[model samples]
Structures are given as C-alpha cells and as structure tokens.
Target chain A: MKNNYDILVIGGGPAGALAAKTAADAGNSVCLIEKRPAIGTPVRCAEGIGKELLKEFIKPDPRWIAADIERARIISPNGTAISLEQDKAGNEVGYVLDRKIFDRELVWQAAEAGADVIVKTRATAPIMENGAVRGAKVLSVGTPADIRAEVVIAADGTEAQFARRAGLDTVVPLREMMSCAQYLMTDIDIDAGSTDFYLGNEIAPEGYLWVFPKGDRTANVGIGISGRKSRDGSRAKDYLDRFVAKNFPNGKTIEAIAGGVPVCRPLACTVADGLMVAGDAARVVDPITGGGIGNAMLTGRLAAQVASECIAAGNCSKEALMPYDAGWRASKMGTILERNYKVKEYFVTLDDAKLNTLAESIAQSSLKEFSVLALIKELITRNPKMLLELKALRDTLS
Target chain B: MSTMLRINRDKCGYCGTCVAVCPEDALELIDAYLSLERECIACGICARACPLGALEVVHEE
Candidate 1:
C-alpha cells in the first residue's frame, strides 16, 4: 500500500467500496482497506435489498442474487399472516442476496476503477493534525504504516473505531443496539419466493424474527432483539435456538453468524475536517427493519462526491464536508428513517393482544400500496382504540 | 478477590457484537482475534450481548 493518497477509505463493506469506486471514478487517487483478510466473509447481514434500490448502484446479477422475493408475509403472535405481493409491497422487499459474492463484486468494481484495495489492513487510530483528521495509522498485515491522505472516509462498519478516534462520539446506546444471531440452514421447508417475518414479544422482544429464502430449501433464519432485553439465559441466540428447534427441527445449519445493528438515530454530524463517515458507521440503519445496505451505499456515494468536490476546490474542512451530511438528511431515505424510528418506538410498546388485534385488522383489508403510511391509515380506520395514538404519530410527521 | 472478564475463543465468532455494545470501548477485534483493552471495566455488558456465550465475567481470588 502507498503511504499517501488523495483519499483513504477505511473498511471494505458496501460503504467503503462505493466510496472508493466513486472517488476513483472522479479521477482521484483512492485506497480502500479491509481489516478482514477477505472482501466479505462471516457475513453479518441478512443480505436483503429492494430491487430498484439495488439497481441504483449495481445491476442485479444471478451470480449474486440468491432469491427473487415475490411476496412478504408478516405473522403475528396468534399466527395471523398478512401477505403483500411484490407489486404492492413497498421498496423494502425484493431480493435476497448472497453477500459473500456480492461484497467481493463491489470491491472488484472499485479496484477496476483504479482504487488500491488492501486486505488484512486495520486502521488502529486516526492521524490528527491540529484537530483535523489527516489520515489513519494502519497495520497492514502485521506491518504498521502511517497512511496520509487529503481526505479520510470512515466507512468502518458497526465498530466505528476510526470515527471515534477522529473525535466523533460513535457509541451506541444499549437500548438502541439490536443484538442479532443468524444461521444459514438447509433441508428446511420454506416458501422459495416469499420472505417471512414473525412478530411477537415472546419470539423477539422489541424486535422481530425473519426467514429469508436463499434458493432451494435453504434460508437465512435470524432474530434480532433489543440489547436491554438480552440476558444470560435468554439471549438472542437462546431465543433463536428455541424457535429453530420448534419450527425447523430437521434443518441443518451450514453457517452461523452473530453481530449488532444500531437502531438509533444517525450521527448528529457525519463529517469533520478532512474526514467523512458513511454507512453503518453513521448508524443510518432503519430503526424499524434494521436494513442498511441501500442506505450505506447511498451515503458512501454521496460522501465521495462531496469529498471530490472539496478536494477540487482545495478545501477539506468540516464546513466543506457539511454538504454530505445535509444531502442525505434531505433525501427521501432520510425522511423514511425518521418516520420508521417513530413507528418502531410505537410498535415496541404494544403487547401481544394489541399486536394480534392490529394484525387481524390489517389481514382483513387489502392495501393498494404496502407502505408504512397505508398500514397506519388502515389501522386507524379499523381499530378505533388506536386512533388517538396513531393520530399523534401522524401529527409528528407533519 | 477481583472481577474479571473471560473470552472463550473457541465459541467466539469474532463478529464484533461485543465491540459494538461495549460502552467502555474495551473490546477490539483484530481480524479473527478479539482482544480486551485497558479500558475494560468487566461490566459484563459484552458477555450478555455475545450471542455465542463466548464472553464471561468471573470472580477470582
């Protein structure tokens, strides 16, 4: 790896890869580093993305697309299933990806765009100059090196150490952190074209369990619960184990993965002098669904674009990078994130009986468009008891 | 006696869930190896957050 570059991106997830590619495409010298030896291994995500959203960055390829989801089913505590077809389902459901191959493909594209890709390189700390992030102190394959750059993009996933070292408070609140566990199982019966979500306090407190098909009879069975709800004997894994035992007793698990997803608000500030943060590092994951792949890519591309503009103008100060933060918050994704956070807060407060009532109400009605707003409207019309609470939520949005 | 945190490397997936929930910023994952920094207070938050039951807090005399 070089000691100096125009831009340095920490982490090799979708965020860093997109940033590197975007910056390099703008004729800027960029280098991307991954702490792991490979581009994507030990996959931490459920690997689901909206079809149109995926097309915004990269075209969907059969090589990376594991399953083409045609329907989404939400199962309540009382086994009430509310299904939405592909056309009616909002932009959240479309494809179940094979992230192992998908992430590598993104990095490959970044390399093809002339960005230097380095693996097994960990950024231990930020190199700060007069309260400004100059670059990072990285350990590349056991050999420590100080890599300097005009701008540093901190796309380093959930750990977010680089941003914190650069004087950003990247700590997630315990209550907002979603402790998650997932298993890739085969020899299980599943709807090959449908994604299933199980919602109930017993199944996953303040969170939900999902069954996402990955072709054949194999699927990704996962659960995410609030960190505050996690305990020694009743942790996320314990909950998942119980569900799997009862539902897929004969299934064989090929791979198991565990991680944390931040369901809190995004960072108050995503940029500092000579530094920018993107993707999960910025905590832009949807609070309700815990989905972030598209958001990460969006922020990554925007950060690079803004960084390139600042570099061209010979100014990389925090003021110059402020546009990156403002740009995302002004976008549709940002508005949706804010709305979803409120929705999640409201739903988590509901008990099983309330959830069952809402599910039954939703099951009876056919939504023309399966969006959060439509669902809320339906709930208001059917359940008069929830009118006040739902109306208050709607007022906050307006 | 003192309270200490222990990590079972065999069970640990090194997925960084502990690192994320660590309010003290005590846990660091270098590649596949998870390490505890000097900031660790042995609060056991990481232990509870660990999905694999890889982390534990114990009292030793």
Candidate 2:
C-alpha cells in the first residue's frame, strides 16, 4: 500500500467511492479507506433514490435494484392515505436498491478507475499540517499508519468526524438530526411496487416512518424522528417495533439497524486548505426526505472534479477548492437542498392534528393536479391560521 | 473514575453505529455483539447512537 497519494478519500460509501473514482480517473493517485471489512454491511440507509438525480452519473444497473418503485403512499394519523404515482410528470421516481451490492459496486468502480481501495481501514483523525488537513491517521488491521495526500475528501457518512476534525462547523443540532431505526422484514404483505409513508407524532414524532418494498413479501421498514423530540428516551426502535407489530404482526425480522441522519442544510464551509467534505459529512442529505444517496454521489463527483482541477494547477488551497463549493451551490441540487432545509425545519414543528389535516386535504384533492403548492393551498384554505407555515412551505416548494 | 459504558447484548441490534460514533474508538462488534475496549472514555456517544437503547453509562459513586 502506498503511504502517499494525490487524493485520499475517507469512508467507502457512495460519496467516497465516487470521489476516489472521479479523482483517480483524472489520473491522480487516489486511495479510498473504508472502516468496515466489507464495503456495505450493517446497512444504514433506507435505499430509495430518485431516478432523475441518479441518471446524471451512472445508468441504473438491474443488479443493484431490489424493487422498481412505481408509487408512494402517504398515510396520515387519521388513516387518510394519499397515493402519488411515481410516474407522474416532473415527479421524482427511482428504485429501492440492494445497498450492499450497490455500495460494493461503487467502490469496485473506484478501484477500476485506479483508486486503491482499502477495507477495514478506520480513519482515526485528520492529519493536520500547519493547521490544514493533509491526510488521515488510520488504523488498518490493528496497525497505526499515516497516509499522506495532497487533497483529502471526507465522506464519512452520518457519523461525521472527519470534517469536524478539519475545523468545519459540522455540528447538527438535535432537532435537525433524525434518529433512525429500521428492520428488514420478510413474509410481509406490501405493494411490491409502492413505498408507504406513515406520518403522525404518534407514529414518529417530528418525522415519518417509511416502508420501502425490497421485493414481494419483504420490505425495509423504518422510522425517523427528530432527535430533540426523542429526548424522552423513547428509541426510534420502539416506534418501529410498534408500527411493525401493528402493520405486519406476523412479519419476520431479517435484520435491524440504527443511526443518525442529518436532516439539515449543507455546511456553510465544506472546504479548507487541501480538504473537501462530501456526502453526509457535509450534510448534503435532503432535509425533508432524509434521502442522501443520490445527493452524496452528486457532491462526490463535483468535489473530485474541483479537486482534480486544483491538483493540476498545483494549488490545493481553500480558495482553489472554492469552485467545488460554488459548483454545488450552482447546481439544481443546491437550490432544492437550500429550500428543503427550511421546509423541514417548519414541517417538523407541525402537530399531529395539522399533519392529519394536511394529509386529509391531500387525500380529498384531485390526484392528477396534486402538487406541493396544492397541498399548501389546501391547508391554508382549510385553516386560515396556517398562512405563515403555508407561506414558508410555498416559498420552499416554489 | 468515570462511568463505565455497559452494553446489554440482549438489547443490542449489532448495528455497529455505536462503534462508528464512539469518539474514543472504544467499541467494536465482535460475534454479533458489542465489545467495549480499554480506551473507553465513556463520552456517551455510543449510548446515544445505540438505537435500541442497549448501552448505558453507570457511574460508580
């Protein structure tokens, strides 16, 4: 293994792998380090990604998809369910992936692009030189090693320590962070082509529970709640357990996982001298949906693109990496993410009654013309007092 | 002495998120269970990250 490289990427998820691949393909010596022995074990994501966003990078390979999602059903506390066809014009549509295979394939692509892939290599900390990140201190197979790099990309997922180590204000407040718990269950009846979302404080305080079909009779069922609201010590697993017992009483649990999801805006500063933060470490996840796989890949590519340019110019300073930051903010994702954060901040504050009202309104409205604006209009029309929140929602959606 | 981080194997789901969030690098999943190592500073991240509430910090008075 090389002790030095042009680009060193931490974490081996979608972002890190793509970053390594992009940089390496540009002829830079790149290395990707993953703490897990395997690329994707103990899967933490719900695995749903938008087709439009994903198509920009890699074509969807059938080997990675577990189910072709055709629609999404939103159920309110009052039991009113609103169904949205995934094929609706201008709507986002995609698949629920077999993340283990998908993640491994991504890293494999990175290796194919000439990036050295090292698994079971835990990045302990950012190696700082003159107050700037230059590489990482790693623990690979119980041996401490220092890998130096001209540029470092941190894609460390939800447990993001790398960016913080590099002086980025990456702290996600409890309210903005989503505590998630999920169960991979089988022998459960579900719409094999549709995803289901249950919304209610009783269901999941300040968040939603999702049932994403992996295939016939199997799904990844999970719940995410605002961490602050979970201060009562009621675990997300408890809510998930109750939801599962009620919805799929006889369902068998195949696997269970838990983690934090940063449902917030992107970091103000994701770049420092010779350092760039991508993926969950940079809080690129959609604030409203808690979906990030697509965004992570997008940011990874952009980060690497700018990093490669800087390396070529022989100036990997913070100012040189500003293009990555500017590039991300200029993209369509940048617009949506900036708006989604505000949407999430306000949406999570709505009480169960308000959510029930919103859901009921959407359910009663015409499905063909239904839109985010329509839902907000319906809510504001029903309750004039909801004008402020509705306006904020309108601002976000527009 | 600080509080000791305790892991209840029965409640643990073996997510390994606790190991990831432990700043002290004191946690690991071995044989489908979480094993606490000597480096534990009991910073409480693992306790918070444990989805099933399987970990606890018991301070000895």
Candidate 3:
C-alpha cells in the first residue's frame, strides 16, 4: 500500500468517510484509516439522526434505517407528558439507524470514490515536520508504519486524541461530557414509530433517558447522564436499569454498551497548519441533544471541499483551511449548534418541579407547533425570573 | 479464581456500559443486573466505564 497521499483521514466513521470521499472525488489521493478491523463495530451511538438534516446530504438507504420516527413524547419528572408530532417539532423527526450498516456503507462510498481504505490501522501520533502536521505514526495490524500526507483530517470521536496530537485543544471536561449506557433488548413494549424521552434528575441526573424503538418488541433503551452529576460512582447504567425495571419489567437484554458523548459548544479552533478536525473531535455535537451524525457529515463535506481548494491552490497552510472553520460556523448547523449549547446551559439546571411545570405549560400552550427556541420562550413567559438567569440564551433567541 | 471486579447491583444502572467497554467481553447483564464471567481480566475498564461507580476492582496483593 502507498504510504503517501494528498489527504489522510483518521477514523472511519461518518465524518472520516464523508471527508475522504469528497476529497477523493475531487481528484485528490486520499487514504481513510480505521482502527477497528471493520468500519463499524461495537457501535457507540444511540443511533438516531434528524430527518431534515440527513436529507441535505444523502438519500435514505432502507438497509440502514432501523425505524422511522413519526412523533416524540417527553415525560417530565411528574409524569406530565407532552407529545409533539413530527412536523410540529421543526423537522426534528428522525430515524433510529442501523449504524453498523450505515457506517460501513459510508466507508464503502469513500473507497468507491477513489480513496484507499485501511482497517485495523490505528494512528498513534501525528508526524510533525517544520512545525506542521505532515503524516502519522500508525500501528497497522500491530506493525508500526508512517503514512505521509499533505493534509490530515482528524475525525476521531469524543476522545479527540488526534487533534490534541496536532496541537489543538480538544479536551472535553468531565462536566461537559455525558456518560451514556444503552441496551438493545427484546420483549419491551414501545411504539415502533415513535421515540420517548424521560426527564428527571432521579431518572438521569443532568441528562435524559431515551427509549428508541427499533421494531415490534425490540428497542434501544438507554440513558445519558452528565459526568458532573455522575460523580461518586453513580452510573448511567444504574439509572437505565431502574427505568427498565419500572417500565419494561419483562424486557430481555440482547446487547449492552457504554460510551461518552461530548456535549459542549464546538471547539474554538478545529484547524491548524496541515490539519483539520471534524466530527466529534471538533465537538460538532448538539449540546442539548447529543446528536452529531449529521453535523459530522456536513463538516466532513465542508472540510474536504476546502481541502480540495487548498490542494488546487498549492497552499495547505492553516490560512488555507481557515475557510473550513468559517464555512461551517456560517452554515445553519453552526448557528443551531451554538444556540443549543446555550440552551443546554439553562436546561441542565432545571429541577424536576421546573421540568414538570414546563411540560404542563407546553401542554396548555395554544400554539399548534413550537421550535426549541419557541418552547424556551414559552418557558420564560411562565417564569419571568428565568429571563434573568438565562440572559445569554434569551439574547440569542431574541 | 474469583474475579477482581465487584458489581454493586444496588447501584448499577443497568446501562451495560461496563459490559460494552470491557475489552475481554467478560461482563454481561442478566435480568438487567451485572454478571461477571470467567473471561474477565479485571482490566478496570468496566470500573472506569461504570458511570455510577458501581463496578469496583478489588486489588489483593
């Protein structure tokens, strides 16, 4: 296999695959490296993606969709539930994806676009030359090898180790990280075409529990808790177990998973000379929802587009990649992500009483539909004092 | 040999994160409670992965 290429993308998830495919399709030699033996295994995500966000990039492939969501139900601590139809939620409708197939198909698309695919190849560190990232030291099938490149895209997930190795601050504070645990189980009763989110500090401190139905009698039951609230040996699994015991007493477990989600604003910087960070590495996830697959793919496409431009211009410096940062930040997703972070800051502090009250208010609201911001406005109208506490959020919404 | 990992069932949330992160795949959830199997190497990944601090690795020298 060739050791040198025009672009090298680390991690084979949606971001890496999209970046690699876009770059290669633009006629640059690209190589996508995945540490796992397969493109997608031991899946870590909750497997949900917003429908409208996804439609912007690729057509829905039936093979990867586990279930199509028609509506969502949010149950407050007091069991005050507010249900929202899909279209009413501002295109928040989504699908529970079969990430194994979806992730693999993305890498396959990359390969089909002329990028080389290497599995079981782990990037150990960035190769710095003249103070710029130029390649990586890797352990390929347990053998050390150096792969050189003009531009390196770090698509590594929440850990963001690659970006750090390249001298970028990608560290996620425990407070900003959400510890998640999920079980793919059978014999659980759920609406096959709807998703449920349960809120309450006891249910999931500083986070929420999700029941995403994959099919009849099967669902992905999980919970994500704020790491700050999860201190003192509190586990997300413990909360999930309690929820299941109470809700699905007869449910049987099929698979269990533990993962972390970065739930903060995007990093201040995600690009440097000869390097760019995409996806979770850049903290491109929605702070309020922890949804990232769509943003990751979008950022990947943008980064690659910028990389192609730089290659054509014969300038692979940080200045050349600056547009990638600007481009993403200017997009609709960038604005939404920024707003969501502010929303999370305010929402995470709401107690069960407040959450229940908020739910009740939503149920009584005359509006037929409401966006997240609209809901926030409705919430503020009920508790005017909240306007003072959420000044940043209030200003953003206004 | 007894496994070094001790799961506090009372505290375990049953998210199975420990089971998922266990490099050896030595952990499983039976009836929504944690069960340690023979393959466990006591790697402490599950201990770290446990958000509730429910899984503890007891070191006996």
User: Candidate 3 lDDT, tens digit per residue, A162-267?
Assistant: 7776777765665677888889989877899888889999999888999998888898998898766664446787788888899999989998876778887788
Per-structure clash totals for the candidates: 0, 0, 14
Best by DockQ: 1
- Give the alpha-carbon lDDT of every model: 0.90, 0.82, 0.82
TM-score of each prediction: 0.97, 0.91, 0.87
Write candidate 2's Cα lDDT for B1-61 as tens digits: 5678888888887765565455555665542456875478876666765667888888987
lDDT of 2 by residue, A243-344 (tens): 888989999998888877887778898899989999988899888788999889989999999999998999999999999998898898888788778777
Candidate 1 regions exceeding 4 Å error are A87-92
* Reference-based lDDT, residue A357, model 3: 72
Contacts from the true interface found in each model, as a fraction, amount to 0.62, 0.26, 0.22
Q: Chain A TM-score of each model, in the order shown?
A: 0.98, 0.95, 0.96
Best by TM-score: 1
Alpha carbon deviation, residue B46, candidate 1 (Å) = 1.7
